[model samples]
Target: MTERARLAVVGAGPAGLAAAIAASARGVHVTVIDSGADAGGQFYRQPADDLGARRPQALHHQWHTWERLRDGLRAHIAAGRITHLRDHHVWLVQRHLNGFTVHALLGPEQERPAEVLADAVLLATGGHEKVLPFPGWTLPGVVTAGGAQAMLKGALVLPGRIAVVAGTGPLLLPVATGLAAAGLEVAALVESADPKAFLRHGRAFAAQPAKLAEGAQYAAALLRHRVRTYARHTVVEAHGGTAHGGTADGDTAHGGEVRGGQARGGEVRGGERLEAVTVAALDADGRVRPGTERRIACDTLAVGHGMLPHTDLAETLGCRLDGLDVRVDDEQRTDVAGVWAAGETTGIGGAALSLAEGHIAGRSIAARLAGTEPDPRGWAAAARSRTRLRRFFAAVDAAYAPPARWTELITDETVVCRCEEVTGGAIREAVDELGAGDVRTVKLLTRAGMGWCQGRMCAAAVAGLAGCALAPSRRPFARPVPLGVLARAGEATGEPEDD
Candidate 1:
């Protein structure tokens, strides 16, 4: 058995990195397991080292903060206080009598199983984008707002040259401006949420001036690039066609190594590439205004409704959840013993809030492992920042909710579940024709959520079409594991569990 208390952090984004550094500083051994090739999670996704990206900071929002975290993590790893496990997809974390057993799959194929035993687990699993389906949503050139950002940051590639960024969130601001700054002609930023609604949460908005300034900066960038902004408008459908002369994306694998080049638009695959998107103004009721439909020519549609917390692992551990997010106390402790959650897993607050929560949780974990009660005053500064930032983002989330009546626009033929090719009409029939009263029933009837993604992409859309609350399916495993891996996961794997 190990003498130093070992903690497992199940992400490497802003939250997990912060927690790992904090815990390591407090004489705790930390293992950060993430699926990315590097430490920075999606928000601070690092370019592959071989690419020699000199200006990676240009693509990130908080470059200085990221630099500090990255440096600290490197220092800790060098000192052997923390172990960084990259490309390990954690499928399930099982609570054991000793502590916890984290079951993960190694490499991209995810055929090989790996296990890590720890005294506690900090879940910073982050979140995923929610893209509501419309006609032609399954087209090749369309990706989530974060997905577009990921392609840019991770692979050093853009989605397309001419793009319409249609989404309703603070995320859209960065994405639209980032694309424009990267030389993509942003045709329009179509936002479904009305700016007028922001006034409702004035006090919450007033709490954080920095966040407001951030939004202002994004708005200014949009203007400098001459990107047209259509307030209270939404994408009705995407149009696809054959395109010639697509920009070659950077650094596709060559001889098992990433080739180096400047970031560029991704090469369009042979299928029909995105050519345009039909946008329409939304009425007071958030329904599309009939006569306001306009077709904007673009090669890509970077669209998203908002975000949903990744709660599969939490559910598997039987952690209490408040609606869609995992429930946590002030120190970011989950209801389950020895489990702490921060970042988007707790809620959809931005990176700063995640950092604060992560710091607090890490400190708490260290104190608990040492068999001592944590002093609230220890993390007082972070707690204050957390409270203020949470208020600020609550207002932002309120103002940026997807168009209230967006479900009304989804045509019967629209593919709601891209994995299963389940259409909106099939979901409606499961609800209206059959006696399906919930998303689970609808899934069973139509196999909408039974695909490889296991309902991650379609749960919200399926719930909306069936007029049911988007409840957690409480999946047994966070992700699908191969039968070979699951058959004897505990007996043999990578290194023996450090129990």
Candidate 2:
């Protein structure tokens, strides 16, 4: 009898979970690693069991799908076909002669090192929010739109009583509606992108009636809560009560016309949290209109500009990237052998796309490991769904893109990199005065991307501010590793034979 081929699936999200289930069912010895304590990723985030709260499914939309995935994972785990390793934060994947070695940090402290050796690796690391900074965004009451949703789903906590959800993405719909449903006062939903753009991709969008219905349900929820929506508008700045050098009052502070008979502008009360946000209308070219500003009083501001695919691990493995996402072939295989990428790492399509891609990859891996060719017909249904979902999301991406001149709203003094406190002025000096033409050069001239986040939060903004195209920064490791882990990698033994 031959030994089963070992597979290491990174991330316990929808993609990773689906891959493990499919592959393991095909007789592969599968191990699933994830940073979260639970199986569900951000999309199916589950509240703590100790919360004693009934009807946790009420917080989620795709209850049936999540249930199936969860049950399948449990069955596989119990049958001894799969091993689940939660709280494993994978930091690096080292290519050996025959296979790969996945090095991860264990637990919340992240000091202990853990390693898993496998014949093949499946990367399902998800995406992160793209945040475009504005003045006063660093205030205490400000949070990412996804961050707000995560808090509500994971901990049942509200960001604040009065919230303003402002962003240019489909994520804003759920965040606003969720907050309103939780009895929080959702002041407004400020969307920078024009809804009219959806007309251009009507054919592609009409192909997915389920997606349209999902969006309509969210719209109805917003209407039920009476959440004021401002399409073709964006938040120019968040005003906190703390005194910074400038006065919060006056037309200049608010930027444009006040709507709904709200106060034009006023001084932020001292020692309080976020008092309000200044939102302005956008022109046809996606530039902000000068005199259409409105001040909406709110205690919290939830903002995000869409998502960026996490390509750090793929880049380290010499995997090709298509635009911002890791590129993979029809079988979900990367250009590099034995490495397959799925989910947001491949592209920012949602959980459904991730699941379909993952299942295809799993079947392909299983067949290839058994020294056989995978018939495309076996996974034709998944492939078809993947195609349709990708097209649907492509339309969504086009319709919800950030405003064209969003950077114009960023004041020279506004801090762009919150990690290193690198301001816009410093970034401009690196480009204008120091001849730093690209994001890398700008990073060298001013320690902007050298912060704790390693440029994850600021890379897009830096590229835009420097007038350069965004490119992947090939990292040696996906996350920061302890010096001990680095030293130990050299001393490890067991060199497997070449494939």
Candidate 3:
């Protein structure tokens, strides 16, 4: 390599930002590309500069850490060690004999092609929310829990005047509190998971006292705001009220998803929106109790089950996966050469674990790129933090498991895939009548996952209804590519060349 070794960090989130700064500080040239207009990823997302937020820190618990990362990145960029490319929607990372070529759409339209050449790549692609379908979920005002948070954080707006935050993961806590803090009338927080179930993992809880205290803080905030929280309760169905002007056909609700049309122009528009939702207590077996049904009125139904790692890029690179997460070794290196992964792409352990893993990956990559053996002792502290957080999150995952019988609660008429307008009944028919036993077969038989999203939003629901694990759908590219971009990709390209 005649020129300095160039590294491409494919996300601007906690992990990618940390890795980029660490590697660049060690003399590596880095290009940080992200789809967002700003450097901060979802966790550190800030209101637009023009918004002139009075106190953006009020929205984040880790604001100081974000300022550190942001300042470091700016410093590196000024010194010519790093470059931040905003609004670059990367669709593929192709390995060449020389190194790698990252293909991306240039802007919001995601049509014009752009490419970046790098000697190595880090896959810090992050994760997306997993929303199980329920009746009336397609109502205009129904949004994901994370989506609601992003709306508040990014756009600095409320989804509705009254909201119900319902989910089964740790993310629901901050989301509900944030909504209440933002002055939204939080009607209730309906959690399907049993709070007592967390006690079963006492060892994990004891190991992370700070995490326990954080939960207590959220509980206190909810109490102070008089936000009703129903433990072991699941949303059986969302109900919509009369529309003033028009009705929505196929409303979408996914957070930090690759798919488009998110942060929807929600109702308050002449669109039909959520008016109320039915919640029911779950039995020991995770089945809903018959007499426990109660209706809560709210204009917004913010619901989520959990989150899944983004592995499309890793899978395309022939990297190994442990379940849905991209598998990585101690240094956060993927099985594939010239590739490293960190953050939620490896697993959804939250920001702290992502930072730890990213720091380790950055230090390791720096050593390797400099042709030196990486000493694990260099990142021993980060590695310890990584291990502890991983253990705690593993227990968290188990404790926050979605209701066991959630699939049975969805009415046949409920739309499962909002992109393609496929219904639960259609998916079930593909299984029972068409004899489709797996997710791919169900997709081919009923077109359940064949929409603009290509199954990202509805894969979990489809797999559950089909009684199968989501088979690795090896997409040629991470997202849909226009025919024009594909045709032009083969022609003489004007990608920046090394000096």
Candidate 4:
């Protein structure tokens, strides 16, 4: 009997779960690793089983899809075709003469080492939110738009009684409406992108009527909640209330009463929690228009520019990158042999695109490992859906890009890097005074990207402030590793050679 190839899948998101199910159905022995407590990843994030919620599906949009993926995974696991390692944080993947070794930290403590050996590896690591900072962004009660949603979905908790959702992406729509539906008083949905941009991509937008309808549904929900929307606008600064003393109306020394949405007082204060956020209109060039500032009172601020692909593992394996995302062929195979990538790592398309890509990749991987060429006809429907979704999201990406001159909103004193507390003044000094040209030089000149996050939150902002193009950082390890794990890995299999 021919032995089935062992495949290791990183991530338990829609892409990873779908890929595992598809490959296992085709006789591939699969092991799925994820950092979360359960399957479903971030998109279909569910409440804890102990929550005993009556209607968990109310928090999700495409509930049926999640059920299918979840059930498929369970069936495969029961049949001994798949093994799921939950709460496994993969730090690195090293290619060896025999196969590949996936090194991961297990459990909440993340101190124990676990390794998976496989003849082939599939990366579905997903993406992270891009946080461009303004004044008071690091203040309490200021969470990313996704973070707010995750709290709602995973913990069944609202960020605050009153909230303001601001950013430039499709994510804002759901975050705002979801909060409102959950009984939070949503003050505003401030969007930085001009709505007129969609008109330019009308043809592309019209091609996907389903996407259009989905957006319309969100709009209807926002209308039902009476959520005020401000197009071509963005948050300039968030004002928090102090414990020392403030007016009954939440006014502080730094900020006074918001008259017509404009703060009439002095400088903004960073207190224990967020109280309000100042928003400003953007001009055609993406710069904040003069005298258009408004302050909306709110207890929480949920903000995010967009998402950035996680390419650390793929980059370490010498896979090609198309701009910021991993470059994959039609079968979702990377240029590197015995490797495949799909989902947000390929681009920032949503869940539908990810599922299609994952299914195709699984079919391709299963066939190739069995010494047969994958028939394109087998995955034709998925490929077609992938193409359509890619085109549709391309338009969405173009329409929702951050304002061209968003950097203008950052004052010299505003903290850009929250990890190291690096201010905008320090970044400017690195460029103008220190003569640093690129992000690397700026990081070296000022300890901007050297903090705990390793620049994941601040890299784009730093690059923008420095007037440089953003590039993928080739990190050897995806997550921080204990020195002991490194030493043990070296002892077990010798140190990995440089590519």
Candidate 5:
């Protein structure tokens, strides 16, 4: 048992960082916990401390916001008002009488269970890429767009010499451009969204012309790099066997690791690594439009559909969720007492919106805890910003909304969950023959989401393939916990509770 903090914020991303700063400034004893060794989350990932990465800002969009937050955090830490714990991967959070108890795996070397008790908790767990399976997605040299970006930012290494970035979101532009800027021979950018969606929501786009200009600048960069961008396109397969094969012929390691590949375009020769990938146009149903398939020689495949909020801790506390996302009021308070959420954990509004939301939530919580009436004025402007930005996000969502007929694209032999080797036919049988309408039921029958990954690798694909509502998975631990830690959680002599 440790001294209880006035407030605890999970995630070191923009939201949690800003919230901690605001709360501490208001005289609230705050603790910010995160998995990163530093304050920035995935958005502002920095290179390894020893790497001497001088131009870290070059890899991020809102560099100033990070600098401001980081400085504020340092000031607070020096003053002893805030306790910032980096590399503290929170595994479990439970609501107590007047507050909550948080369990975390602290530091890279320390394995002992570290617990933090708090009067209030704010969840800013952030989000991860949604993996929608394709025919050749299970191949070496393939990675999520964000994952590839992380490699460039954190390790200062490119996944390959020639990379093809394909996805349906605005993130693809930056990833492709960043790889190209790093001297990688970017083959092309394949987007699955119709460009007309911008026109459909012209007002929203007009409201954020800066975003449009940013996109335009990225386009100009792509042009300068001689990178071809194909809108309304997708990578059908990653073939290692032949230049024209429709299937990927290598090992698939999801979640950011590129197993193997070599450049194979122009001066880049392909021999023992990723040689080529098949790019194609998807019909309205998300299936490969037969004749649109074209072989594009490349060394790496970077792809992602979108992102989903990480809401397990909030869900475990029985906080009310709006659809799959945590339902937060204008002030970012969840239904559970002493709990709040902001940033991508609440919803996907990118880094800028996350900072604003975090500041609002922090201010609101600080005001209420100090026995003062919550004015929520600062948050009002932030809310408006969130609304405007979310509209653009909604437009993007609608544009890339995975086609309804994509479930039919999966062949009976195609593996739905690579971890378990569960096939499309098994999932279909679970749904059609076994009356499994929901994801849990399908998992129970087909064991698709029951593999080592615990469904992180295949949840989005399963949900989309089943045409069911995508829900945030609720588990006792945020990540894999040691058995000794579990035993330390409680007595080891008792039998496990029945499901």
Candidate 6:
């Protein structure tokens, strides 16, 4: 905090770690900041010490790669070239005449606003799960696919005795397979991608039969575990039970939900416990193909549509965006001077691509600092392994790109905004009756995006439901700031605020 660091990397994930090492090796004084206490990002979540997990590597893939990164970080940290700060939740980044200042909230109380000054910055903030809303989705037993995996890997706990993994993307296979491996009775693996899409990209898939074979291994595990697989299907509704806290069961193929009732105004009607679910096949529009509805008896449902980049800091710095991702040239340099981005924030490549991009960006930044030409020989070699993988990912994204007809999935009674308890009907009324065409206008009228999350939860769904463009909003304060802190910083006193 006293002397400004020459290079600052946000996020301790693979990319950030690699970048810090790459820069430090070149003699650039570096500092690494992360929200989690560990160097591994979501990909490498070690169990708590109390758990006594003897072999944490058993729950991870590419374990050797992580070990190398961790060892390198220790060397750099000890050498005095790198300063690693963990549990720092950076909320904003501001440009200064000298370089830039990164602002973050340091602890659970969030009262402490700390600042880090850096001559060059690298943003490797990862991605967050994309949740597509449905009835009973807010129930206690329902969680995201990644969240479920995190629980099994990090806490060594299964979400429920029986689990249903439903969503798009390749993430479902590993999650379901891992749950089954962990002794959970996986009810089903529901995927919305048409199998034919894989065939369409058969050449690319053939080029990397290892990936195909890896997927086959997962399929074999699911089959051995008796976990049913549903293709081109989705969970349209979630029903609890008849009475509050009662058990849930379906009367017919798509009839009943136990502990909770039908999803009404986005709120579950009945109880706290989740007992069953109703799933249906969808046509091209993501609507329930009538007569295809079926019920599955499971205590927990894990569903996630896709992912999006965490681009708040990048956007705040006036970096241009390409489509839904941050735009970066070959070297991963953003338009902003001394600023760079990588990982899912730049695009929706998985951890492997993110690691590669991070290395390239790190080397580029380091070389520039040393007054040498930036060379991408190392990063490009790893990226070459993606000859077939990248194509498959692209196909996967296109096939599952939020069904264009999802607008018809929600009824007026269905709740779209969980925090505000706002229903699909209310959002529709805001557009039709109240003439709320924009996300801000709808937020003002229904308070949909004004909940504890400050719009991260329901903004996209609301925008999609209201037929508005999915755009980001720029705010004065990135996170909740105490009035006292604002006053101490010598900033104007805003009205009363709460987090």
Over 49-132, each residue of candidate 4 has an lDDT whose tens digit, in order, gives 675656778778999999999999999999999999988999998887777888889889888898887899999999999989
- Residue 30, candidate 2: alpha-carbon lDDT: 94
Residue 216 C-alpha lDDT in model 5? 87
Error in Å for residue 73 of model 2: 0.4
Best by TM-score: 1
The global C-alpha lDDT for each of the candidates, from Candidate 1 onward, is 0.85, 0.84, 0.85, 0.86, 0.77, 0.76
Could you give candidate 5's per-residue lDDT for residues 1-499 as a string of tens digits? Answer: 3446899999988889889998899999998888888888888887787766666776677678778888999999999999988788888776655567778886785476777778889899998887677666666677889998887877766776668998778778889988777777799899877677667877767788878898789989999999998877776667664343322222211222332443223332243345688777877656668898898888688888788888888877888888778889888899887789999988787887788789888998999888787886656877778788877777666666544455665677778799899988888888888888888888998899887778987887788667787777776667778888877753222332222
What does candidate 2's lDDT look like per residue over 238-317, in tens digits?
99775432223211101111112232334455555677999999999888888999899887899999999888878877
TM-score of 6: 0.88
Candidate 5: segments with Cα more than 4 A from true spot: 1-3, 108-111, 241-273, 284-286, 490-499
Candidate 3 local Cα displacement, residue 375, angstroms? 1.2
Taking all chains together, the TM-score of candidate 2 against the true structure is 0.92
Residue 10 of candidate 1: its Cα lDDT?
97
Measured with C-alpha atoms, the lDDT of residue 411 in candidate 4 is 88
Flag clash pairs in model 3: none
Off by over 4 Å in 3: 1-5, 243-271, 490-499
Clashes of 4: 3
**Candidate 5 overall Cα lDDT vs. reference?**
0.77
What would the TM-scores of all predictions be? 0.94, 0.92, 0.93, 0.93, 0.89, 0.88
Global lDDT for candidate 6?
0.76
lDDT of 6 by residue, 1-499 (tens): 3336888899888878888888898888998988886788888776666766666776677889999999999999999999988777787666766777777777777777677788889999988888878778888778899998887676666666678999788788888887777666789888877777677767766776777787888889888989999888878777776444422321111110111223212333455756678877878656668999898877778888888778888887888888668888888899988899877788776777777777777888888877788766756775574334456567657655545566676778877788899998899999999999888999999998887776777878888887888787655555777776555441222221211
TM-score of model number 5: 0.89
| Cα distance off (Å), candidate 1, residue 428 | 1.2
C-alpha lDDT (0 to 100) for residue 310 of candidate 2: 83
Lowest lDDT block of 10, candidate 1: 250-259
